[model samples]
Target: MHSRSERELGSGFPAVTTPLHALTLRAAANSIRAGELSSEAYTRALLERIAATDANVQAWAYLDPEGALAAAREADAERRAGAPVGPLAGIGIGVKDIVATLDQPTQLGSPIYTGARPAYDANCIERLRQAGGFVLGKTVTTEFAFIHPGKTRNPWRAGHTPGGSSSGSAAAVALGQVPAAIGTQTNGSLIRPAAYCGVVAFKPTLDALPFQGVNVFSPTLDTLGVLARSVADCALLASCLADPGGIPGDVEPIGRAPRLALLAAFPWVATSIEQEWAMHAALATLRDSGAVVTPVELAEAWHDAQRVHRMIMLYEGAQQMRDLQAREREQLSAKLNAALDEGREFGDGAYHAALARRDILIAAITEWLAPFDAIVAPPASASAPADLTHTGDPSCCTLWSLLGFPAVSIPIAVADNGLPLGLQLAATAGADERLLAVAQWCEERLAFKGLL
Candidate 1:
């Protein structure tokens, strides 16, 4: 096994000459647009990196080097011909396996959908392509984007979990296999993995990015998110996916230090020694940076937020996948089958009640958060767990997901075990732009170097 320092320098393998794959998404795009770098060269570099390192990391579910090269050539051709190019022109992005891609099979990390290809691109994929980005390949997801583990191993250490079900997306971005990747979060799928893998993850306000054609787990809580090396990269990708008007410019500037609320308590979850220490260090950093960090507690209405979120997820997930439950129960993993069985026990009244409770909590939380720029908390119970049999806890992410709030996970410190510790910042619904701006601000203050 390679040392952590070597792993930080791209992949666990020796660094390649040129190392074009190490460029940030924004930098790569700008260089390509300026004719300083060819799309083909950039894509080829990333493909080479993936080839050298993926045997152990196993970040990709599918990779099409030939297809990616062809797309890159076309992008270069269009730019040379002076044809209109989109904002993400020439960029290669990894798509989570659950998102439908007409060109690649989306197996949903399950045997039931083995080799299944969608007839059309998911709306997010369509937007990405329309912006001149090409699909590098699909990254692995947990079975049906649920609790099952995927083949991916954390880039930081081979044995530790790379939090899922956005397992491969976070790992790939962290290792520079792809500059940025898209992941989804019905619960902690996006945030936890990014935290574990030492990358930035942005879960935009609910439906901020279209979800059409993405395999549905729970329409109520499912949200499309982006994982990338930095907050700016995430913002650029999100802007393209959310609005084709191109990346937003001349935006409002945050004129003062952000008012941040520290989430002093996470219900039903115990903090690891590493996490507690990391939080202490982060809070001191923020205070030293002239930002106001105040201790805040969840309101009474949010005490049962996790339970409510699970009830809604299971109830809706079962309904969405009822056909599969009936026809392919035997093929499904035992963990998933159990979840389905439990979901079926909830009747219409119970499901509706959960939704109602969710609405009340959302209202209360939104009002409570109205005074702050964003609320800060640990992204997970700890750094990635030391086993592959399970993903890390989702307690830190459940309430925000349930309320459809916008959240971002930014690495604040590294744990003693060489894993990244991320601090999560969540804003009220429809506060995505503000949240991103705030996250970037905090990121600068933290000065997190990630694995690099």
Candidate 2:
């Protein structure tokens, strides 16, 4: 028998028919502001879409349709009253379950806090509210945002994995359940999932967005990010969350073509042939579009990035989960416990040494990469795996996460299996705005038409 997704997506995975739910974040906000569409109408369409698709997708941890509609009505009322509406005035955003939401539960994808509700909104959520966006629901996350996979499945094809730990956020956006969603990355949580799901993921420099109300696994490496259908959408959502003044429209143009440094394959990782072909195709397209594409090799000092990143992540993660481990050992997964065990074996001296080495390499690589606008590589080793037992390997993302660089993943091609492929563009730390601009420029040249 044919599967459900094969039926829903169709044999060709045809261009998504233009429905109200298929509107982009920018288009939705503009329509609501222009009185051409009501927030309630837009929200109802999304709710119906979620209801129709989420049975197989399972992208949400918690959803309250009634509450979401109520908030949508409030936004419409404000616009009717002639009050100034924010840039994201009527947008519905899906928050990762780990982020605190006063109105919904932040379950952390663990049984230990099954029904736990936060008393206040996370800093990012509060900012999103100020920008006139409402939280549609909480998306599922892996246990403590660690290695364990969640219930989310790839939207392109059924029975395939969506890379974690930001599994649900990426899938929900790709499925048109929400225009944009909040996610975080310590290693590859944001980029890998976005790549696997055929969406845009932007992980800004470390601490670009605050982590105050988000559950912490590795305090040093944890960074808040956003997932959306397009590069401009990611820029909008991320800028809204990071800005203290709550500017929701911060997407800027790159006045000229960008210079990109291409690494055909990531170091010491097994990349699929499909992924390599996609990268080459993307580079050729960019070159034809008058952009500079130069091939570059990794510096010798950057050889141990994955190992060092693991050391720091596990050590800090172990400390962060210490109390929970002591109190509810049985409630945690064997995979998490195993990681924690490895982390505990890392003494303070070893952890500090890793940190010291990271500092030196950061400076070395940053200078080496200073000449280029971005370092381009494949975001993940391959398309989403055939089954959902585990998320894909994250070795390609380790170096950028370790150095606290700003990165964006742009969907470029679809694999032979009909799964999407993406290329990662990373820039120096503190160059977030410039990185977004370059990504936008590259995105225009690539002209990726994503599956809805």
lDDT of each: 0.87, 0.88
TM-score of every candidate relative to the true structure: 0.94, 0.95
Model 1, 268-338: lDDT tens digits are: 68778888888889889888888888898876657899899999999998899898889988889899989
Instruction: Candidate 2: list runs displaced more than 4 Å.
Output: 1-17, 245-248
- What is the clash count for each candidate, in the order shown? 0, 0
- Structural RMSD, model 1: 4.5
lDDT of 2 by residue, 287-330 (tens): 99888988997866577888899999999999988888989989
